[model samples]
Each structure stands twice: as structure tokens, then as C-alpha cells.
Target chain A: AQTVTQSQPEMSVQEAETVTLSCTYDTSESNYYLFWYKQPPSRQMILVIRQEAYKQQNATENRFSVNFQKAAKSFSLKISDSQLGDTAMYFCAFPSGGSNYKLTFGKGTLLTVNP
Target chain B: DAGITQSPRYKITETGRQVTLMCHQTWSHSYMFWYRQDLGHGLRLIYYSAAADITDKGEVPDGYVVSRSKTENFPLTLESATRSQTSVYFCASSEAQMNTEAFFGQGTRLTVV
Candidate 1:
């Protein structure tokens, strides 16, 4: 069983500032995928970024990037130059490498960008 | 244009009543999943199907039943809706390929009173 943990329940960042949301997971599987999803006020889940366990290099998508430390079992999401639109509930998720396609998500970190 | 959609965006039902949430995806992904989102519990998987008629249990499968009769449709039913079952439900689908990203629906907010 894989479990994702987001220690921070809520976070706030000033506009144009950078913010990092921490995430850690426990999984025995060597091959897996880590993802960060954002749910805005519309309640639509959107993919932010994703990182594969095998890839040593971190994944970056525009302003969103991930610091994936496979050895430490840590995958953190960094939002650079945060904007108001970045204010949402961020979740860290993992998908097993095998036939299991279901995602194991963290409790989520509610991010608020103050102007 | 409709990638994925969940019917009855908001639903209200009484306890012990039977309620079904419908999910449909146009992407024709091979994998479909049902998950419940609560305040404290982010998203707990209820059930997932790899292909049509191939279903499997997830972390939280109690009190929920799922069926995938077609490749694009996966419906979740609460046999006897309880107050505990009141939460937002999200349906997602993904390709069978490993490490592929999963697409999510807008989600259905269900209230069991």
C-alpha cells in the first residue's frame, strides 16, 4: 500500500513570490509515478506536474516544478512567481507502476496567494 | 469537446436511499476510477476498473458499488446512502500505458441527509 503525506494543511504566499509544498510517500514499488494536482474554486482537478520515480531529474512545467528525491521518498511541488490563480488546494498523488491506475492522494495543502 | 463528465453535479438524497452517480468519458481511456473527496480525507479511491467489466477494490470501497458495463461509462452506486457517504465524488480515467496522466471530471457533490 502506498500512502502520500502532505504535512502542511494550509499555506499562504504573497503575489509574485515563490512557494514550496512538501510531500512524502511510502511505497515499496520501485517503479511509480508522482503527480501534483490543483483543485481551484471550480472544483475541477487539474494536473500541475508529474515526475517518474526512475527519472533522476526533476520535472518542471512552466512555473510549477517538482523536487523529487527518490531515495528520501520525497516529492515536493514548487510554484514560482505565484499568482492569484495559483490559490487552490494542491494534492500530491502517486500511481502504482503495475495495473493499478488509481491515485493515492495526500490530504492536500490549501494555498492562498495574498495580493 | 466533452472529455469527461459526471452527471447530477449536485445531488441530495436521504439516508438509506439508493443513489447512483454516473460518469462518462469521451477519451476512451482503458482505465476508470471512482474516488470520494472529503474535507479531511483528500481523495480516497472507492473502486477502479482497468477495462470494461474488470473492476477492483481500492482503499475505501465499503458502502459503494461500481460497475463498468461500457468502456466509456463507469457508474458508482451507494447501496444504502448514509450520512458518512455525503461527500464530493470525482471520476477519472487514464490510458493503460504506464505513467500516463489521468484525466479528471468536474466531480459530483452528493449530500446524504
Candidate 2:
């Protein structure tokens, strides 16, 4: 079984400030994919970033990046120049390699961006 | 219209009653999944379908029923809705292969009284 864990329950960051959300997972599979999802007040799940297990270089999408340490089984999301809209619940998820593509998600961290 | 959609964004029902949630996707993705999100539990998979008529139980499959009659539609049913079953339901779809990105729907907020 694969499980994802987000240690931080809540975090507050000033507008335009940087914030990092921590995530860790337990999986025996060597090949998999990690993802970060954002759910705002509207309750829509939005993809923030994704990292492939084989890729040594972290994934970056504009101001969103990841610090992926495969050895330690850690994947953290870093949001730079964060805005008020970034305030939401962030979830770390992974899909173990297989045919079903089942996704396991973390409990999530409630992020609040204060202006 | 072009993306995945779940019907009755918000629904309220009584306990022990049977309720069904509808999900449809236009992407024709080979993989479709149903997940439940609660306050403490972020998101847990309930059921998933690899293709039309090929469904499998997920982590929390108890007290739930699912059917995939067509490639575009996958409906989930609760034979006897309980207060514990009250949570947000999400429908997602992805292309071939588990490594591909999965697209999530807006989610259905179901409340069992």
C-alpha cells in the first residue's frame, strides 16, 4: 500500500512571500509520479505541479516548483511570490506505476496568504 | 462542456436512503476514478474504471456501488447513506497509462441527514 503524508496542518504566508509545503510518502515501487493539487474556497481541485520519479531535476511551473528527494522519499512544493489567490488547501498525491493508476493523497495543508 | 462534469453539485438526503451521483467526461480518457474528500482525509479513492465496463474497488469501497455502462458515464450509488458517508465526491479522468495527469471535476457535495 502507498500512503502520502503532509506534516504541516496549517501555514500562513504574507502576500508575495514564499512558502514551502512539505510532503512525504511510503511506497515500495521504484517508479511512480508525484503531484501537488490545490483546492480553493470554491472546492475545485487544481493541479499545481508534478514530478516524475526518474527525473533528477525538479519540476517547475512558473512560480511553483518542487524539491524532490527520491532517496529520502520527500517531495516538497515551493510557491514563490505567492498571491492571495494561492490561499487554499494543498494536497500531495502520487500514482503508483500500474494499469489502474490509483492515486493516493495526503491529508493536505491549509495555506492562508495574508495581505 | 468539454471537460469532466458531475451532476447535482450539492445534494441532501436522509440516512438509509439510496442516492446516486452522476459523472460524465468528454475527453474519452481510458481511466476514470471516483474519490471522496472529508475534513481530515484529503481524498480517498472509492472506485475506478480502466475502460468501459472495467471497474475496480478502491481504498474505501464499502457501502458503495458503481457502474460504468458507457465510456463517458460512471455513476456511484450508496445503498444506504449514513452520516459518515456525507462528504465531497470528486470524479477524475486520465489518458492511457497511470503516469499521465488526471483531470478532476468540480466535485459533488453530498450530505446525509
Instruction: Report every candidate's CA lDDT.
Output: 0.92, 0.92
Error of 1 at B17 (Å): 0.9
Tens-place lDDT per residue, model 2, A3-57, is 8999998999999999999999999988888999999999988999899999999
Could you report the DockQ of all the candidates, in the order they appear? 0.74, 0.73
Candidate 1: where are CA atoms >4 Å away? none
**lDDT per residue as tens, model 1, A90-109:** 99988876656567899999
The deviation in Å at residue A93 for candidate 1 is 0.7
Backbone clash pairs for candidate 1 read none
**TM-scores (chain A) of the candidates:** 0.97, 0.97
Q: Compute the lDDT for candidate 2.
A: 0.92
